[model samples]
Target: MRLQQVLSLVRKAADDYEMIQDNDKIAVGISGGKDSLTLLHALNGLRRFYPKHFELHAVTVDLGFENLNLEEIKALCESLDVEYSVIHTDIAKIVFEERKESNPCSLCAKMRKGALNDAIKQAGYNKVAYAHHKDDVVETMLLSLIFEGRLHTFNPVTHLDRTGLTVIRPLIYMNEADVIGFVNKHQIPVVKSPCPMDGHTKREYIKNLLKQLNYENPGVKERMFTAIQNGNMKGWPVL
Candidate 1:
């Protein structure tokens, strides 16, 4: 997708959820993946013309993996004129070597978010942006239903009472395919994940399963997304 198209969807989600406020500073959580990079580009473009002025700051929590690199990401941020920060931590060691948890994604995610949130709070930012898109929403809802026996997904906006930081999902309206298209068209520097279990996770399973289901039953994905929007779930934006 083009930058303009990406900005349109992001703007819609932000406006619908009342995400950005004037003079608000948003910290974009950059995982060095396509989704987060696309979000960075979208929000940077949006602030250029968005009525409610806001600032964008890029952040990444390094899991202390051997192959992880941030030089290119720093260059990208410099080109976009957005400040970037990377929090270094031994999360990989704690989760894999020390704790040796069978299901490491959960613990690793908690640690990563903890580090990210601490950095955001210390920097005095009020809100943080995550790059969860339409496909992620559907996949998460399916995961909850199949595992937890509930029909639920994340909200576009969430307030973390403990950290006193609000989280926003401006890319909630975007599809993963479009995100890939944007990254390819713009030649965005996407750093490959250094984690050992990058593609071997429950979410990856659900992603492929959803793809097959959509192929067999056309429009199922869109229908599911519509259901999420109209499901009247708590914390969902009422448009």
Candidate 2:
């Protein structure tokens, strides 16, 4: 039942948005975590039967984590038989030493995305896929509404001007729990976040708060997810 739900969501996103195409050389941004790894695995599952003859390659930005090996990511990609690349950036040091941000997740996220966008483009892949799931979209929507005074969420598919890249999120329909379950089932070796302050961030708090709300009112999040799925979001000026 769980697998059916996940595949349903993935297929809906692919069909609804026309994300993949024949002869597409897509770069999957791998962040060495469950979300990204789960995406990689899911895409691998669908690649052969995907309506289009597309290729999946894994790319990770080395943010200078201590004891981190680019080899693990390489091996993971090799095991999957997909091409891989590791672009280095001093993000960890920059966040701690230069920015000195108490809550660095926001800035760190932006920096890492920028780096990945640039790296992927340079590697000659115009289409890049990310592992941002449904929860990430909801959190982004909440963050924008509360902090930016706008109700906006990242689209499942978007074009980044800096890199001239078409960024797609194939896992936008699956939630974090589903991703974790898939990863555990497959025994995927995922790299932990290099951040020292992983769970203390404001987004984590929001995630926990949402979880509690979901517990109190079953289907609260599910209903919200359906709302997004049903709505004509493209008509919005924000997109």
Give per-residue lDDT, candidate 1, residue 63.
95
TM-score for each candidate, following the candidate numbering: 0.99, 0.90
lDDT of 1 by residue, 1-239 (tens): 89999999999999899999999989999999999999999999999999998988999999999899899999999999999999999999999999999999999998999999999999999999999999999999999999999999999999999999999999989999999999999899999999999999999999999999999999899999988998898888558
lDDT of 1 at 145: 98
- Indicate the worst ten consecutive residues by lDDT in candidate 1: 230-239
TM match of model 2 to true structure? 0.90
Q: Tell me, by lDDT, which candidate is best.
A: 1
Q: Model 2 off-target regions past 4 Å?
A: 1-8, 234-239
Q: What are the per-residue Cα lDDT tens digits for candidate 2 across 1-239? A: 24456667787787777888788888998888888887777787788676778888888888888867566777888888988888888998999889898778878889998998887777778798988998887887677767789767788789777677898888987888888887787677887775688788777877887789899999888786666666666522221
Model-by-model lDDT, in order? 0.95, 0.79
Off-target runs (Cα >4 Å) in candidate 1 are none
In order of listing, the candidates' clash counts read 0, 0
Report residue 125 deviation for candidate 2 (angstroms): 0.4
